[model samples]
Target: MPNPLAAVAAVMIAVSVAARALIAHRGYLAYDDFPILSMADRNDPTPDYLFRLFNNHFMPGGHLLSWLALRFGGFGYGPFLALLVAGQAAVSVAFYRLLRLMLPATWTLLVPLTVFLFTPLTLEAGTWWAVGVNVLPMQLAMVLAVGAQVKYVRTRRPLHLVTLGLSILLGLLFFEKAILAVALVFLVTACLYGDGLWSTIRRWWPSWLVLTGVSLAFLGLYSALATSSVRRPSSVAEVLTFIGQAISHTLLPGLIGGPWAWFPAGDGAPIASPPPAARWTAIVITAAFVAYTIWRRRTTASRAWLLLVFYLALVLGLLGATRMGSVYSAVAGSVPRYIADVAVVAALAIGVALCGIQEREEKAAKIRMSPILLTGLAALLLSSAFTGIRYGDEWAKKAGRDYLANARADLATLPAGTVFMDQPVPEGVVGPLSAPYNRQSEFFAPLPEGPVFVTQGRDIRVFDQAGHVVKGWIDGPANRPGPRQGCGYRITGGPVRIPLTASTAEYWHVIRIAYLSDRDASATVRLGDGEPRGFDVHRGLNAMFVVVYGGGAEVVLESGDPAAGICTDEVAVGDLVPAPAN
Candidate 1:
């Protein structure tokens, strides 16, 4: 007969993987996927090429995987999604292995393992391809490193130490936050084996010293070579504030569902704070747990108490080091990708506590289960799983459908070499579901002459040279209003000429200018220094459409009108295609 416990664990793992696979059909996100795919299209996956591409980036492993996805997966996201699910499954297995080492491998251990597998905090990490690629690999490496540490502690084997070191290195290669794995290994060692704090340090000085040295060396290289644009905590106040906020965000969301579970968006529904009652209750419960843990520490250094402390410390140190990057703000600390590791640690800490309680009860020759404890644990597990699945469906179904519709609409109309601005997608769209191509104007590269496209919600509009939406082309509501409704360049009274260089002269056929003026005015617009044409502008907002026949056009705003000069809001020149008449 099969061990029922083992069967349950296997079933849970299978379910988790199956759930992830079902949601993996969602299309590519714009965040890092677009840039990675673009890179893959341009460069070959050679050692030298990868080195050059990732020399300034800390995540070479992520980049390599993305390159492979593009090379082998073709344009479809199915292959990349498969890889993500596979990585997550491996992390789950590694987690189970670590838990087995820490607690008795009995049916009870399956509870925490199941909860960890379905933790709502993993939803973002598991769904988004780019996030999953970066996070899942690092998580797997961190778990393996912890497992290696456990093996080394038990067997005192040199091979285990070597494995520990290698795993740490692999984690670091995947993400800078992997350094926390080293700290966790040391903390676990001290808690499990050391006679006292100082004694543990004295014994493990050499190991920690080596790890610290490696960390410093890596930091030095990263500082010199890394070109990431993320801002670092600039002052002591910022660092402290970030640490405090990160801790709160991690603990609160992992313990109870909150606004952080929702995917952020430009026009999404507002996120409501947890009710005051619920908030205070969670705080009281957490305080009680901490107080009890501390009280227990005064009597005996039980493994559970020590493990809980170590886990908290690990969470603090990890968030402090990584969350300080500009990529993460204090408010954004609860982001699932950032806190997935914390969820794992919290699960382990809970498992260890349960194990300690059982051990104590056995020693006393009386086994008693607290209904309150069991009820609370069950509630937390059920709530987290419910929230995770609910949001996972939103991301997979609603967001996925919106993204496909937008991609198809834009791709069908927009031609190559078109320079346009991006409109933020609808709120509640979890992944990037806006425009198909890159939308960040700040980093857009020069393109050859082609048709330009502008977006307002899901609607793509063609603009004329005077910066006006082309009439008769789009027959719908004149405009779609949202938070980012009017996003474009604001040009004051000056010679604002949309530059059409030699490279972009032929591909573009028309220039669209969307503008507004305080008073009535007219400006001379020239295309590629060709014959100058005069255009009249009305008060308030106006659109000017001009055909681009040659190189590039220069718009000379005449300053004759003393009144507020024309404010050019948006300008785009590209291949303008008229929509089929309705």
Candidate 2:
């Protein structure tokens, strides 16, 4: 007869993958996905481009995969989605392997694996391309490394040591935080397999030394290249608030299939939005489970739970120090991606506590029926599935899909030689913080056969709110008519200054020159004592906009070419905008 437990486990794994595949299908590239793909498309496959830190993350492996996906896959969504699904499946299988090694064959073995597979807590890491690329591999490595450590402790094999070191390196290539995987292995060995902590270190010093060397080498490279400024909690109160939000609100409920409510997270994916009742119920249930496990006598349950708490503290500490100042800090814990690896570790901990690691001499026992436990497991699975489906639907409705589709279609239709005036994407796509990446040039780089983009152009257009190409103009608080009544300001070989009717403020602003030239001229324009910028004045009447720094009382224009001359009548200092309709 077929083993019922094996059949059940297989079904759960299938359901989990199918559920995530649905989410990936419904999802579109969002936020950082734009920048990741843009960077990949813009640069060639050089060590410098591949290994360089992106927004503070040193993820050469993820970048390499992205570059490969772009090279072979083009701009289609298929390659990225396939990579996400494959990575997720690898992590699930690696985790199941770890469970098999750590626990005996019993119905109890399936519970933690089930939770790890279905928890809505990992939805973001599983579905989002940019996040999944880094996070999924790290998760896979953590499980594999832990399992490798278990094998080494039992067999003391040199092969297992190499595998363990390779696993850590694999994670580091994808995410800086994977350094924590080494720490987890230490926790597992010292707490679970050791007769005493000191003895374990004495016996395992060589393995520890190797892991440390690998981590230090990676950190050395990371410190030199990472460009993001460190964000630290500003106050004790802020730290405490982050802890409460991450632990009490996010982590606890997440473990028990919760944050039962889903709300759209501004322009990004939906975040956990559990009501008060959901939060408290999660707390009661999870707390009771942990307490009962620890209170059970003669088992290594306390030690296993201790390992979990230590790892949780480590994760919390890292997040509290770095992410406490986030714009979404209030809901930082509710964000699934940050704590995705925690679910993997928690599963390992659950298995260790329930079924001690000691090998059983008896044949694998059949799963004993327990009415209460079975019902609770069923409820958890059902709750998680509902939440996952709802989150996927929310993801499908996001604006990124429509925006990318419309922009890509329209860009292909633009006339040849129509250069775009660079600007940040519509605020709905991403915020100002994304910078050079959020620039129209970078944002649209992945669109196959897109038009060229330049900072300043005489024949330039702009993407309007709906991403359609349109005539570009500059609108500013200060629009200065030429000081002269007629003929405006003329340029020969020397500088010509036109005083402004209103003073421009001290900030980055665009200046537009409306001019007519009998001949093309190479010229320089300067704002009050700021650095001079070069521009071209074409024959006949035309307008050009250039970004300038510092405030000024006038516009200064000059031609380097003695033979070339131009006339300008107006200057506008502020932002670039779509030209107003006649």
**Candidate number achieving the greatest lDDT relative to the actual structure:** 2
lDDT of 1 by residue, 1-582 (tens): 897767777788888877766655543453445555656556676655554433234676776787788777555677788787888789888888788776666555765686678766676677776677667877887788778866765676778777877888887776777777777777666765567788977765656666777788778866776665445566677677655544454455455543234544322211223344554565676667656544544322356456656766666555555456554354545455666676666667656555443323345222123576557657765776666555544554444234434444454565454444332332333223334333322112111222344432112354322223333232211111112335333344555554432233433244556676777766655555555555666678767655534444333334335555565535555544444546
Task: Report the error of model 1 at residue 506, Å.
Answer: 22
Top-scoring candidate (TM-score): 2
* Positional deviation of residue 12's Cα in model 1 after best superposition, in angstroms: 1.9
lDDT of 1: 0.57
Candidate 2 weakest lDDT stretch, 10 residues: 360-369
Q: Write the per-residue lDDT of candidate 2 for residues 93-132, one digit (tens) a residue.
A: 7887788787777787888888899888889887888889
Error of 2 at 556 (Å): 3.1
Stretches of candidate 2 above 4 Å error?
1-4, 227-231, 295-298, 325-328, 358-367, 478-496, 506-509, 515-525, 529-541, 546-550, 557-568
TM-score of each: 0.67, 0.90
Error (Å) of candidate 2 at residue 536 is 5.1
